[model samples]
Structure formats: structure tokens, C-alpha cells
Target: MKRFINKWWRGRIAKLDLCPLPKALAPLENGRVLIFAPHQDDETIGCGGTLALLRKNGCEVKAVFVTDGGGAGGLPEGTVAIRKKEAAAALAVLGVDDLVFLDEPDGSFRNTLGFEQKIMAILDQFQPDWLFMPSVLDYHRDHVAIGQALYACWRRWQGTARAFFYEIWSPLPATWVVDISSVAELKRSALSRYELPLAHCDYLSASMGLAAYRGLYLSCNGQSGLAEAFVEAENNGIWSGISERMLALRIYFEKLLKR
Candidate 1:
């Protein structure tokens, strides 16, 4: 891994067109990291490996699930409770002890009526050094809603955490990536804890596959890596830009779905 990464120091860039090679993450010695997951399994699907890596590097990782996860049709009774339990077990695999559930209506979650307040409250309380959120471009309404509400909450946010938007229902045009080759299997195990999502969709395999592919940007001639992609929104201006793009995406998806 060091050999391949050293290529960056030797003026090596761009593995190929459309694959603007992402770099590895610098280890965090100590800091508080918070993640806002739109659903129970999304946290594992999107950044479980990164979370594991962060823990290994001594970062305190916390998670927040914004939905009850009852929107997916055909789920068994008590889906909300079942999924929450699953999330608890999963995050434990990644060494995260703190978890918060917002219990918003899954499919109908919007950016108003206390959504922003909830986010602001968490932001105020956590005072994280790093924060993770769903991509603004995600097709899931709940995922987009979180981004929208966070943008609104940013107006009063006093925390100086750098934001990273992770991929779930959408693939991010990532600005950075964290190599998680060592913790990939841990992530798989974490994701596998979601029995409900696993029964309906092969999210475990899909998420691992995406991580492996993202690692290619960091891969040289060897296959010793997996990675999580993210769009870094480091400030209020960047958050505003994300909001504008999210609005455009909402319109585009609305029309596309109608068609």
C-alpha cells in the first residue's frame, strides 16, 4: 500500500479518465466523529469500514439514524425495532457506542417541522471534529431530506467539523476517499447484521463491491484495498452549494420518476 501511495509523491496522477484516483485518509489520532444515517443499514452500507478504521485510529465515532426504516414495503412486523437492534449490533462491530434515532417517517421525511431543529440539536450536543452525512444527490427522499435539513441547520451550527457526504442510494462524485482494506471484512460483517435489508437486497455484497471498486483509485498493481468515497463539504458555502444541487436533483428525479 505504501509503495502504491508513494506514486503520488512521484507526480503520478489520474489512473484513467473518469477515475480521478482518490487518495488515502490521514489517520486521526483523537477526535469526535458523528454520522447522520438516513436509515438503519445505510451507516453500514456507506461507511462502516471507514468507521472501523477511524476507531482503530482512536477517533470516537457516533451514529444517528434519521428514520424508523418502516417505509420499505413488505418488511415484517416490528421492523422499526428489529432494524434498530440490528444497527446497534452492526455499529458495535465498528466500535461505535453512541447511536441516536430520530424516528422520522421513512419515506415521507421532509426538511421541515423539527427536522432542522433535530439536526441542530445533535450538532450542538456532539460538537464533533468530523461529521458524516448522506450524499445530496442520493435518490432516496430521506437521504436528500437529511442533507436539506443539515443545510438549514448550518446557519446556526457552531461546530467546526469538516463534513463528508457518503454514498448510499447515490454514487458520490467523490472528492476524497479513505482506504479501508484492513477493515473491509469488518464492514461486511457489520452490514450483514442487517437481516431485514439483507433478506430483501444483497446490500452486503453490493456495498463491498462499491468499496472495492472505489479502492481501485488507490490501488496500484495489487488488490490490497477497499475504500469509501465522499464529497467533502467543509463550510457553510459548500453546504449551500450542495443544497442548490440537491434541489436540481430533486426536480430531475421527480421528472424521471414520473416518466
Candidate 2:
């Protein structure tokens, strides 16, 4: 039954018209991009292809790890150290050398003013031309917190950078897509570096599946390869719904039910 549903879902997605996504997000010469991940793997799982492409185009990319992934259960001791090493290796694959670790408590990201200020400080310091983060609707509590925190800062930061939201635990209603076919293999290889997490879950396959699902939204070559999806900050209503505080309350309860 599950297999049938999966196939049906794929077919239904494939038959839909191309989603209204812009062209691939390539970085300008010497451009800068900053990405925030609730955990180490989310960055690679979400936009590894885009990062690789940006680096190849002489873009300076920095990834900020919001948590150490130590909060996840069923993991061996020293998992945090292991994941950091894995992340470094993976980023190295894309020629990315700038990495930041916030060391925030995993599964406990509160959308507080202090937290927002910390993130805002980073944004003001980096002033990256492109900012990427987990989607607020992401099922993971940390993902939602970081997304909402960044969203809050974005409301005040006058920087010219464009913000985008990515997905991992849950698929987002994407308003933009990046053709990742060329870097698909690289993205897969990068994801495979996480031996610790891969031992627990086949994240490589899952990442590929999501990327392929996004590919189905493309018209070129009739979905030949992987693509990454994102929702532009201006277009996404993760905060501007009914009321920000009310929406937050609704999402909090919805998250509880989903759990």
C-alpha cells in the first residue's frame, strides 16, 4: 500500500505544470552567501548542489551550524564531534572553508528576542548577498525556530541580500527552484560523508528523493535530474499569516499534533 501511494504521489507530481520557480540561483562574481542549518546535515541535504555551483562561480559561501545534532536520540557518544568532522569534510568537497558553529541547544530553539539578536548580529556582520535557512514549516522544532528567528531579523535588516528557505524533514511549498542536475552527483557524494547519521537513517537516499521530487516540477527534459526547491522570503507567509503571534500559536499546536 505504501509503495502504491509513493508511486501515485510521484506520478501526480510529475503531471503538474512546472512550478513557478525562477532560474538557478547562481552567485555573482565574488558574491557571498550565508546558509543556516538547524543541524550539520540539513545544509547538505537542502542545498548542497547550489552551494557547489556557487563556489565554482567564485562565490564565497559560509554555513552556520545552529546545533550540534547531539539532541537527536539513538546516537552514540561523541556524535557531535563526529558530525562536525563529517560536515567539515562535506563542505571541503564544495571548496567551502568558512564554517560557523553556534552550538545552540538542539530541539530547544525558542523564538525569543535574545535569540533573534544573536542571529541578527551575524547577519549584520556577514551581510551576505544570499541567505539560506530551513523552512519555518519544517517539522523539526529547531528548524522552525531558526527559520522564524531569521525571519524576524529579516524584517529589520536592510541588507540587499535575498533570503531563501530550504527543506529537510518536511517539504516546503516552494516558490523557487534551482536546476541541480549538473551537481546532483556531487551533492550525493557530499551527503554520503555523514557515516554517523547514515548509519541511523539513509539520509543520502532521502535527500536524493527530495531533490528528484523537486526536479519533477521542472519542464526541461521532463524531470531528468535533481533540483532544489525554496520559498523566497518576500513570497513566503510563514509569519505574515492571519497574525504573526496567532500563526505561531497555531503552528506550535500543529507541531504538537504531528509529533
In terms of lDDT, the best-performing candidate is 1
Model-by-model lDDT, in order? 0.82, 0.81
Worst 10 residues of 1 by lDDT: 11-20
Best-matching candidate per TM-score: 1
TM-score of 1: 0.86
**Per-residue lDDT for 143-187 in model 2, tens only?**
877887787687688788888888888887677778788888889
Clashing pairs in 1: none
Residue clash pairs of candidate 2: none
For each candidate in turn, the TM-score is: 0.86, 0.82
C-alpha lDDT of candidate 1 relative to the true structure: 0.82
Displacement of residue 92 (Cα, Å) in model 2 is 0.9
